[model samples]
Target: MSAAEVTAMPEGRGGRMTRAQIVNAALALGLIGFGLGAWAMDETFLVTLATKVAILAIAGAGLNLVLGFGGLVSFGHAAYFGLGGYASGILAHHALNYTAMFEWPFVFEGTTSMPVIWLTAMAVGALAALVIGALSLRTTGVYFIMITLAFGQMIFYFAISWPAYGGEDGLPIYVRNGFPGLNTLDPVQFFGLVCVVLFAMLGLISMLARSRFGLALQAARQNRQRLMAVGIRPGGVLLVAFVISGAITALAGALYADLNRFVSPSMLSWHLSGELLVFLILGGTGRLFAPLAGAGLYIALEHLLGGVSDHWQFFFGLLLLGVVLFARGGVIGFLAGGKRHG
Candidate 1:
């Protein structure tokens, strides 16, 4: 194959593939290739693994808005992620059991529809983020971080004690939720569905990042006082970003539950929240394809190192340390020659 055939020639502003854009395009194509290869090999497990990376990438993308652009160090994103999972699981549970979600609320019933589940998950995630952001945004620096962490823990403990939906044991979703015209039971089909959502969200984030609001958000992060001087309310901007971030993460959570056929308090754990952050950092915070890059690398490491030793995480930590110490711009930065344009 010729070089032109292998490398994507997608045009950018100057009719050239900027380093960052090239990196993003390459990562996306890599994911598509991985998924296709898995399907071709009849490796359902690999297909499912690809789906996991896409789903987690969605969550990481959500977190990146606040952490990367808005400079918000929220440690409670797991609350929203877990909430999204519970939303889908609980709805599927009630649907399976033929139970009403509520009687007074116009006799609402549970749904197995993927679209419905996703909408509900986004709403719930946005609401939770609103509440969390409203309170957490009141502080800054370590205070904001601690407050977010505390809220996440609060949700975690609540889920553990709530016996209605399996409590500490978690809830099981027997059947995969149905998409409009897809056989969700088929791993390849399910992976495609996830890939679509992931790409759509990525496009949405890319647009937002380039839009006027995104600029303001970034400015607020760089200097809230300057933003205030320029007539923009830094708090409000940050709050909106946080809500959007939460909703996106929640959607990932919902998909993740369906992927595993299970939802549990562990999803709400602080470790998961940290993992989301790690995904963004590992891939390249603030970059468009950072989430995918981070998630793919993380999963690859987990599989390879996990097979060799249980203490893989110790070595993983060392690699992460190296990335932090040397390649501060992350995988994308390292690949793009550390120019940091995106």
Candidate 2:
């Protein structure tokens, strides 16, 4: 190409890039730059904080499925969250203690593999959801909300009373879990794993929202009678969504347990359940990437504000209240203008 022609070309393209492509390219470049910067900094605290944000984002995304899309408005999701955490902790404990988890007709042993832990967490969470959802789904409006809250409290109390795995004292992971060839003890590798999981979950959620099942679920959420008339069982659809939602949250729980290297009754608390919902509201519900963005911003605010003043949470509460009252769509909706479905 001639020098004159090259000079006349747009920076992003050989000629000129469309607005959409330019925006996407900029975002990709920005993320790459941020990752490179974090790698170079090698700051333990920041990296750890970022991992926490990612984990919280995953939890938020799961909760969003129920609250935002399904319109379930569950207040007891922390039960699944804590269940996933404890599952990992208990398994790791048995493995480290050099004891088999079970020896039935078949042998089962504890494992630190990320994949195994994830599956265990999902299974446990799904089972819990099955029971809770079955009962909770029977009631509608305020009754459903109360039942879910009650179930959450029940699990929390059970965790606190259980003498195993430190009870109220909590269980420590000692070392981060392993992922095949990856050295999870390394901050960057751990962070990368978290990022991969977060993105994967995001992708899964997006695809689910586009699927026919998702359409039916949304319809059931809006009008149960109508969906039933259309030959779709509303309860069944909601039940499936609930299970998937719980499973995703449980995956987050496993990551969280590994992140903190601890699992306590506190993980099962109603307060945590509320916080997960809060993260969804703060980010904007229904949008695919809202949870991730919201979690990142929330953590950043917490870190910055906490460092500035001991009364930061008080002010943070005020900020959240403002968003709830004034910002209808959360931070993402505010930035993006209108709410984007799917």
Candidate 3:
């Protein structure tokens, strides 16, 4: 093959837009159209489902960063998710009840503000990720996965045992938190708000994946020794990625709690962690929209199949098996016409 032919490999697959890019565009438009259509028809239930998709997709994107890009298979991501949920729940609980969260250290109090909750959630998530990553990243392979799982379980049990937060019964907000200049009580308005956050985070994730730190982190994943030989510390790069990933997921969790007007220990369950992983695998790991695509499919199938059969998950499992066995690149890769490589 000539040098030019090899260099023009991408052209052979696409004209103006690559298959993946086309797929991405379609997915984005499809989601927006779905939400708008639902809003127009006053289908509040469907709109809420769409909101769930956006929120869960954000959480899955967080996992994709660590698992796909960083090659870190963390099984305890639910820890951060739950923490974010609790952050929203706890703060709103105190605010609504007119109680101070803490009287000491400058008279800290709770807030009913959504923006404030999001910031607090991210901070809590990042702090937890720092401690977890510092220890878990010290190991490799399954050991790292197990360590994360263990930490997640510890948080889960603690949440269950803590009576102040309603213990196993979970905490409820009774009302959705307030947002600036908007009636958050309205379904469409809330949906619009979540959609905005979803896209913004998606843009940020794309930038991080293309940034210098992103490349370095990818390098560390592919070849740790080579990354170090180039004078870049893989540890620092990975730690930063882990913390950022956690913060993003935590933000999603905060939104989720607000959407449901409740927070529970179930958010910290290993099952939720598994669901996040499932979303990535179903969509296609390492792609920008993998999390969104996967979560969309999962939620759609659940809603549709759920109407027909009580044991809908049994059929869902069959479809998931087919994807795992035959479509390694997941829904996006299959539709995009090729498998992606890290």
Candidate 4:
């Protein structure tokens, strides 16, 4: 068959493929092919890497809610990350020990249910964001950045000093959390779970971006005065965005904790917050799937470079610096050509 015929056949079999459809199909095939290859070699490392990509992408999506859509540059999202992780770790510990979380007013017991843990994490994260966003939103520019950073550091130190859950030592999740019938310990199963969460978050964010509220949030980000003059409260818009962003990031934290079967204060550190920001920039902020692309590329680079040398991080840093200086749009922009707005 001719090249055109071969291409058309794949598209026809794929059922009316658009650009996105073709890209997604290619990605799916690539992943399936890679998984089969890994299985052949008795290796699951790539599966783990893909999980990392999904988890990070989830966090990046949360960040994108604020940074990309709301035009808020928060330098302290690691606070939510660490908070979500600690929430899971603490609950799992209490449940495993069959102990009550607190006896002051009411009884709170831990369970192995993923949904319950995720809800708790999201709630805690939203509350934290509400408080932080309230204070941070009072300022703009450098002051806003500094305030967010301070809040993040505050949580980081608190986690380090808290004697519970091993304090600085971190807590281990002895068993993978249950999700109905799935054996989460299985790489493929866990990977599937991650993919589901990532896609769900992507769909939700995409919908939000197209909603009236999302438009207001974007308007507030671009020109707060104009939004206010148009009868929209910018502060309210920002607050909602911040809360949603935190919740999404928190969800990611829960998954990440399960992925490693552990939680540590380091998860809430400033470095992780910076890394999330880096992923957004690297992937092209505001693009729906930029985080996924960026996370995949970052993890792949880390894996390949680490295998090559011990000082790979230094090279990674240099490469990132080059990207920042020269590449205005990042991986998605490079792949997709230019930015498109709705």
Candidate 5:
């Protein structure tokens, strides 16, 4: 980033943090504090909840790159998400069973290593996004949305029909994947790992938004003609963003699969794609930390409301409507005092 860009960022007046910075700091630190508190209390479930927020936040952040910045309403992001999950699940399955993934392809074996699984998941997501986005980007508006959704469903059905792993029944990991020197079985340990990754992703995203390519992305979104006049290709920029989005979300899916010790078609379903969008909208579309805020609010509300009422989504839907209508900046924007575009 240029010195001008770095200097232009708001750090607040009189040596104080900006409102958005304060809120962003709280969101990041608060999740760590909450997880630690849960660990102190031996509340494994709550720790898991915090981890879920971090994972979902990662997923939401990825989608935000595409929808919030790239101006692509991808209703099929779950395709990449589930692909990542299955990637993890399948690798773990073969590793545990002492079987080769395929006899062909140089006799490659599965792995229980978290790092390996994450890399593989991200690659798969990126590749899928490349092909799908290439085709889907050919259209605009609702046609693009439908095409993405159609691709997602095709993946979803393929997962169901393929019984080698689990098919419609889903595949089980049996045991959580391994991380270097960490007790993967311990909720707190896993939560710590996931939170670290989430914060790193947020930082990377923040930097990307201020980078040259990031500026081009926004320009494409705001004015394709203007970006084209500047000799920037909107299609290429958007496609890159879409692929990056898929890869990040897929990483989250892999972590999620590890957390749950299972993989299912549900991960690839349109419902999840919609829920991700809801998280983005709820947290604030363009906000740097919107994913965490949105997913945290969503899971919190679901937990609180589900205990009191079975039809909790009805109330949640109403709240979502309110956010869409009034809180365009989402929870972060509402609290931080800024425009989504700003």
Candidate 6:
């Protein structure tokens, strides 16, 4: 290729939007339209259903950052997800009951504010990622995967044993907590809030994927030795990506807990982590909108098959297998007309 040809091509894939991008954007808008339509029809349940999809998509996006872009397969991401839920639940529990979180050098008070709780959750999640990444990044391949899972299980059992937070029974937030000016009790209003965050996170990931850091991370994944030869430390790039990924996932967890008004050990389970991975794979690995598409389809299938039969997951597994074996790029990849390496 000539210099001009090389220069004309944009970073990551190409400067132009991919088929996946176009489809994903349309799907997102469709979701918004559906939510608004449901609100008008007085079908509040549908609005809540859409809101659940948005929240789960956000969580899947968080995992995609590491697994898709960063080339790190973490089987224990539920740790961050659960931590975020616990953060919001614990704070709201205290705030609703009129108790202080702690009385240290300065009095630590609980808050029912959504913004405050989200900030706390993201911070805690990022910290956990930093610690976990520091240790796990020391290894590679299956060892890395196992180390991450071990860290996740450690937190899971800790939460189970902590009696202050209801132990294995779990904790509950009596109310959904307060956002700035909106009446959060209204289904559509709360859905709007979650939608805004979901799109923002999606856009953030889009920009990050095209940035220099994202390029370096992808390069490290493809060839760590080459990246090292170029004077970039692969470990540092992966560590940063992991931290950001955890923060995003945790944010989703907090929102999810608020939506349900409950936080349980199930959120921290390996099953949830596996499900997040499944979402990515079902949509298309490494595609910008894969998480959203995957989450939408997964939720839809669950709602549909669940109502028809008690063993819905058996059918779900068969579908997942079909995708893995026949559909190389997942649903998006199949529709977009190409693989996801781009």
RMSD of each: 4.3, 7.4, 3.9, 5.8, 2.6, 3.4
Report the CA-based lDDT of candidate 1 relative to the real structure.
Answer: 0.89
Q: Which of 4 and 5 is the better model by lDDT?
A: 5
Q: Rate the local accuracy (lDDT) of all candidates.
A: 0.89, 0.79, 0.88, 0.81, 0.89, 0.87
Candidate 6's residue-wise lDDT over 248-270, tens digit each? 99999999999999999889988
In candidate 5, residue 177 scores what lDDT? 97
lDDT of 1 by residue, 1-342 (tens): 011111222336467766777788888888888998999999889999999999999999899888888899999899999999999999999999889989994887799999999999999999999999999999999999999999999999999999999999999999999998999999999999999999999888877776778878888878899999989999999999999999999999999999999999999999999999998888878777888999999999999999999999999999899999999888987887654222
**Candidate 5 least-lDDT 10 residues:** 1-10
Which digits, one per residue and each the tens of the lDDT, describe model 5 over residues 97-176?
A: 99999988588779999999999999999999999999999999999999999999999999999999899999999999
lDDT tens digits by residue: candidate 4, 180-233: 889988987888887789888977887777677877877877799999898998
Off by over 4 Å in 6: 1-18, 339-342
Question: In what order do the candidates fall by lDDT, top score first?
Answer: 1, 5, 3, 6, 4, 2
Query: On a 0 to 1 TM-score scale, where does candidate 3 land against the true structure?
Result: 0.94
Model 1 misses residue 2 by how many Å?
30
Off by over 4 Å in 5: 1-15, 340-342
**lDDT score, candidate 2, position 180:** 92
**Global lDDT of model 6:** 0.87
Better of 2 and 5 by TM-score: 5
**Which candidate number has the best lDDT?**
1
